[model samples]
Target: MELPTALYLPGDDGGFTATPLTIGPWDVTLQHAGPPAALLLREAERVSGIEGGQTVRLAYDICGPVPVGPVRVRGSVVRPGRRVELVETVLEVGERPLMRLSAWRMRTRADDPAAAVARDAEPHPAPLEPAGSRPEVPAFFTTDVAYHRALEWRFAEGSFNAPGPATAWTRTRSELVAGEPMTPLQHLLVMTDAASGISAALDWNTATFANVDLGVALHRPPRGEWLGMAARTVLGGTGAAQCFAVLFDEAGPIGRSSQSLFVEPRAQA
Candidate 1:
């Protein structure tokens, strides 16, 4: 069988076909949450019909492990508003449902310094050097997965292979889709799924964590290609955990992202 060249390719029936880029950490034969999530938002934006609105929130629920290969993506507008719109996208492989994504798109108001009275803004550290590369953390064997190779990453603080909180700058070199240009929101969404790996509270060799859901809220749309995430993972004694991150671009803080994880010890070999 041929390996996937891109994340997806258009299908004859209006749905797009899935590729190996969908592969996730849990299984090589399965798909990652990042690609599908971004793809869902892409479809949702198309269906929203809002001329010029920013996606304020993007959330996803992982129904189960998404298998690799051809999957169908369907999107529709669930709520309509002049200022805001709600859209949903579902990914299914054959007859099995994999995941569902919901997004909130809001219209942008003209920027007027006089009218912008005390706008809430998040504080961010000085932006990392975009042109420099840091050493890769060896502990992140998860990075060995096929999907992880699709993007370029530079860590300024914590390494995905190392424990504790981390600050990472990431970007994609290849198109998520063959011909379609990826949006700023899509670029930001791609890195949101990396939150858990960026800052591991537990050892990857002994513990396994899978995020069951992902939620992202953006104060504003990202401007440049470089997306920086300052992330931390928290694991509880009760086998529950959360990963949180503050997102930024070269300009400044754009928003935040979170993940609810299913934490457990990996079965001994």
Candidate 2:
């Protein structure tokens, strides 16, 4: 058999929705790399035709299996208005509904004063290394990129061998999703939610549990694409664990993300 690759989904052709990228427990298919939370928003932005960096608020009522391959995504403004638009995006495999994403966005004013808030706890990002020295197949990600050609990934502090609270970076190998100026919120959607498996490795065994859910709230829109995330574990054990994180780039702190994990014992040797 051939090796797996870090694959990217096609935007215009419904990236990985063309087939069953992966289907496993607490495991996301390769076609769907990031969590459903923020991805739902980003996908909604494109399939639904919302402008980039728009001040958008979106929510998900994830019910059925989020299938992959030749998937069709359709979206529109629910409560269309001059200042803001309520948009929705749906994922389909042929004629079946796999997932639904909804969003709310608004136009803002210039020269607005920034709000006062406590700073993010993550420190300055560590140096980034070359991404070519590791295994090509995705690690821990349920969706094996056996067929897709996605992006390359570089870990800032941790790899599969390194310990907890590491930072990593990824981008399209062939620019499937790029060129559009992204906000910190959008970056958070991709990088911040990748804490579960890595967190478990840093604190305990190699793969102790998987994430139940992850949530992120942006105080302001993102300023650049060089996204950074500092992930650390705050709690664990007894079938539950929590991870805290700080996200940013050269400018300053962007926002934060929290991940909850459901624990299972290490497989008997």
Candidate 3:
């Protein structure tokens, strides 16, 4: 099968058309949360009047399944300040909103002494090299899924079939939008939503653990195309589940990501 060129194609009227590259393993007609989350962040950063600022926190709420078609993006700065600001972005399919993202942008401190303190305090070692890692796709994913084909994955720790924590390095082969290079932040956002799937604690064929919300906090900007995630999922007896991952770059740890899941048994086929 021929792969899509990019996850989205831009329109003249400032809208975007989702490509097959955005398809998730769960549904072919709907988009994976990764692409839409990244798209929301892309628009969030474009809101004017936020100068010399960087997004430190992102909270994305998935309202519903995002359809694979035209989408309208809207962004605004809700709470503005010189040193800090709050921005919000929403993705809509026609008149229905599918996803919303709220971000906190803070002023950059180039010479902050806290940098040194954090460097010394949090000394997370790098994971195994992607080149030498195993390139294995889980049985849960069909070979025809575009999201799996669009990303290169190298497992450094647990396998996808293993019912526990896993560490893997991942990167997208396609750009976020046609003709536009994806930013580092965009790249990170695109992969953050997969934390639960990678670190699933239950069998994919038996259970459905879909994340309703994703939260990310970044201490520093990610560098390089390859991103690593050391992730795990926790399921509670009360029908609540959550996934956590420490975001990494080639250099080292950059941030943390989390997802709140809505767990249920898979429908009998």
Clashing residue pairs in all predictions, respectively, total 3, 19, 0
**Angstrom error at residue 29, model 2:** 5.9
lDDT of 1 by residue, 1-269 (tens): 23445677887777676666666776677777888888888878878868788899988999988776677888888998988989998988887778899999988888766533433353454245667647353444443545665567888887777689988887775567768777778877777898888788988778889899999998778887778888988877798999999988876777889999998988877
78 Cα displacement, candidate 3 (Å): 0.2
Worst 10 residues of 3 by lDDT: 118-127
lDDT of 2 at 250: 51
For candidate 3, lDDT tens digit of each residue in 181-249?
888888888888888988989888888888999999998888797888899999996678999999988
lDDT (10s digit) by residue, model 2, range 148-215: 22334556676544556666554433222334443345545655555553444543444465555555
Which candidate leads the pack in TM-score? 3
| Clashing pairs in model 1, backbone N/Cα/C closer than 3 A | 22-31, 22-32, 140-161
Please state the error at residue 135 of candidate 3 in Å: 1.9
The TM-score that candidate 1 achieves is 0.90
TM-score of each: 0.90, 0.62, 0.93
Off by over 4 Å in 3: 111-121
